[model samples]
Target chain A: MAPPTTPTLAPPDAPPPSTDLADAEPDTGRKRGLTGYLLLLPAAVWLALFFVVPFYSLAATSLYDPSGSDFRGYEMTYAFGNYVDAVQEYWTPLLRALAYGAAATLICLVLGYVLAYAIAFRAGRWKNLMLVLVIAPFFTSFLLRTLSWKLILADDGYVVDTLQFLHLLGDDGRLLATPVAVVAGLAYNFLPFMVLPLYASIDKIDPRLIEASSDLYAHPAVGFLKVTWPLSLPGVVSGTLLTFIPAAGDYINAQLLGSPNQRVIGSVIQSQFTDAGDYPSAAALSMVLMVLIVALVLVYVRRAGTEELL
Target chain B: MSAARPAARGTRPPAGRWLREHLVLVLGLLVLLYTFVPIAVVVLMSFNEGTRNVYAFQSFTLDNWANVCEDQSMCDALWVSIRIGVLATLGATLLGTLAAFALVRHDFRGRSASNLLIFLPMAAPEIVLGSSLLALFVAAGFSGQLGFWTILIAHVMFCLSFVVVTVRSRLAGMDDSLEQAAMDLYATPAQTFWRVTLPLVFPGILGAALLSFSLSFDDFIVTNLNAGTELTFPMYVWGASQRGVPMQVNVIGTVMFVLSIAVVLVGELGSRRRSRALSR
Candidate 1:
């Protein structure tokens, strides 16, 4: 979905950098030497100031005394206990965010793998067209997309009415304002994240390898399990990370699609910062969430046998 | 409905084999359908004539599209989002393209560190990035000043990373021999760069700019924290959503989808024509 470079020429069909090529290039420390640092200076400075320094500020803000208010300026009492307080106060949402994100990532995996596999292998000349379709929805406002789900899964909506008629749902049961709705939104929104990486890895696999495995008298399923799955591990690793991280932090789905009871940590942190004006607790919650995600990602990448996440 | 199997060489194809062969593709289409359902709803709802402020598609009409700006607040919010998006895109594309060029075409110390910094913004959740930036602004005594400038800062900050990553990939994938060949013709470095390098790299830069705009436009989380009282389009949608969003929002949504798809398709077709011409 990226724009073409030249006005007269179309961009190549390479997916955005969010997908493949994570480990494509290494720094050779070669060529136009002096100008490199000059060119890099503006961005490097910008990131260090805005991106890096904000972390320091956030950590400091998180340590402010619990008694602090937005009106009466905060004091950094080094109240590391704020972290403990954050968990104690909002653990349900915290845990719910992680759980929902995990569930959505898994669903995205199953669906995205099939789509990616199909596009990579079965699409032939239509591969590029299908890839465009994968990212088409992403261009729309995410909030609008979630809002549509709110419409579709409403009490009187077709999906809900059908389910009720089929006896799959009770008379008063509804899909809107439910955890299922939230997870479904997450899965839909992040599906492209999963599909792109899977396509990248699966597309690179040699068709001959699968044929060779089949010729060796292995069953198709066995061939897939032994050869295809293992080869696609890197994409799986990257795709899951891309999907899970954003899904975990997303509040829009939980906010618009699910009820108040489905409030994830993102919602809590948002309200604390914007509505409650409780910067310290919010900062503390943000820190905890960041640390937890980082720790989880480290363990996941290590286990997934791919450290290409940088 | 079944096709003829190799009757002489093999037994009848197992049902399981047929299912297995097409299962993934079928499931994939279903998933694609699932994704499109909401988009379809967005389009259909744009034509909805629901008088109530609830989430149901009542009768159909083009009133929403015709009178989209009847809600002044929504239009104002859209304006805010567009302004922020355009400014952020320009700033990010300029800075990011330079950084991308440096990383891909030149050697430098702390290259890995810069790359990590670029990647970290993307890897970090929006909540974390937003809250942290808000903290920075608040701490710097800009608590009251958190609106357009602050939102712009946050937008550019997040967008810079993606911009860098996008342009970096394009630059990295580029063949340097073209520039070398240009220089071999005794062309000056500046002329070769302007004539050869910029045209080649411009696509990636344009792509980065487009991405940055969409991201900035659609962003709500960071903007919510840093925007203070100013409402962008997404923020307006979020606020209005609680009371059942207006159909005009759906109009915007449908337009966005159509416009982006049109842009992508034109680019695709143009590239196809160019490649065909090149082959000829």
Candidate 2:
């Protein structure tokens, strides 16, 4: 989820002194030199030790000799062949995860935009209440909520029956253990990630700009296209990245709501590590997924012109 | 209210006009309702009587709620989750608050680099984070001891970034003149900090703590990777799902939902009241 950066509600009387202090001379400003470093040292060290060092460990683990088992211990063979083997064996699930993630993210974007827009522009005095409602349902256990989806979309459930009755599904069509269920589950779980960022941006839009466009004879849709969409690009970029990253790596939906056919890269990696004890292959797969997501995010962020989001 | 004025004046508005005007709100609400469908299921299933087909409702009964601990393992897992959640929240909140203050209140070298560092963990997928940590643990020869401490470390690592972002935003948006005024009035630096600054920043800290607790408690992916034999609530649920989930699981789920919503509502109401008081 996007970090909820509450828009600054600067008191009416308080002059915005933050920037003024920044512009002031160091001598005239608050003491800054050693205290800042002192404060930062703990977290910086924590991140360095746990976060940064682990990446190096993962990289090293990815190169270990695949012939070795955990009990016998592995050799540091620097086996680049592990990557090749992983790709050769698991590429289907890898690509499937990415495709599912993309489909789910697109779905979330449309649904999220409408909900966010309504909350921002239409909810009036009910804005905060509606925002709370958006997150309230999500406060329940994620696994439990997802399990509910399994029951809701079961073979005998109303959703499938309704679809069949509406002539949208075949008489024997089932929802559980299907790609549609996996994607829908992904979209449902990650919708808040899309909505919150979008709401943050859309809520900041100056309503007068839309009115001004209308005053100049622009159609409502045209006004939205020219003003609202461009202004909300930052949120769109962040939301899509947030949604896509987790969705691609997620296996819970695929495992619970889907079948063997819907297994994703995450499930593959998990099974390889725990079940197969093939640490090298699992590490290689994880590294590949991370690299691919990072590459896609970079290109997407660049194209969207929201580098500041980083 | 504006749309209701003409109707109040004894003129019946066109049904189509009203629908068109409020279309976005209706659509938005429908989406919200859709999100809650699963929660509704969870709540409804909490009261369901025991049946062979756990997925379908059999009959309404309160036995599950009454005997939430019938499955002793589930309660044990819940306890582990709570302990880890509280410890992780404390560690993350302390380190993160300090870092947030450093980033927002003072100028420093490598500030941009630090910001990027904070952002990267959030951007990285949980699978990757979990795998990387597991790899590290294996490499360090602690693979045999993958349990509570390891889970706590992973939770704090992930939750740290979110805490920093939350507190940093609040600190950055804050006005510092109050502190300056306190100094002008001859109060000590610590006095001003404890009295004025801490009180204002406390809400953001509390919010971050709550966020961290929820994230830690509900985590499964990372915990499953590091927790060799220890079970968390989510892990227990995942395990149960493979066989047949006990109705008591739904009881716990309902309790979590109700409790969290209560907390959020209370916080929201308190903040609103505070703002109203401030305005006066």
- Clash tally, candidates in order: 2, 0
What are the Cα lDDT values of the candidates? 0.85, 0.87
> In candidate 2, what are the lDDT values of residues A194-283, reduced to their tens digit?
999999989999988986886687877899999999998888988899899999999999999999766899999998988888999999
Q: How close is candidate 1 to the true structure, as a TM-score?
A: 0.92
Model 1 Cα lDDT, one tens digit per residue, A1-310: 1111122221322333333334333333235347878888999898888989999999999999989887898998999999988999899999999999999999999999999988887666777888999989999999988877777888888899999999999999988888999999999899999999899999999877987887788887899999999999989998999999999999989988888876899999999998888999999999999999999999999988777554
Model no. 1, DockQ:
0.50
DockQ-based class of model 2: medium
Instruction: Score residue B190 of candidate 2 by CA lDDT.
Output: 72
Chain A in model 2: its TM-score? 0.90
A251 Cα displacement, candidate 1 (Å)? 1.1
Q: Write the per-residue lDDT of candidate 2 for residues B94-205, one digit (tens) a residue.
A: 9999988877765566766787788789889999999999999999999999999999999999999999988987877777777667767887767877998889999999
TM-score of chain B of 2: 0.93
Worst 10-residue lDDT window for candidate 2 chain A reads A1-10
Return the clash pairs for model 2, or none: none
For all the predictions, what are the DockQ values? 0.50, 0.51
Backbone clashes, candidate 1: 2
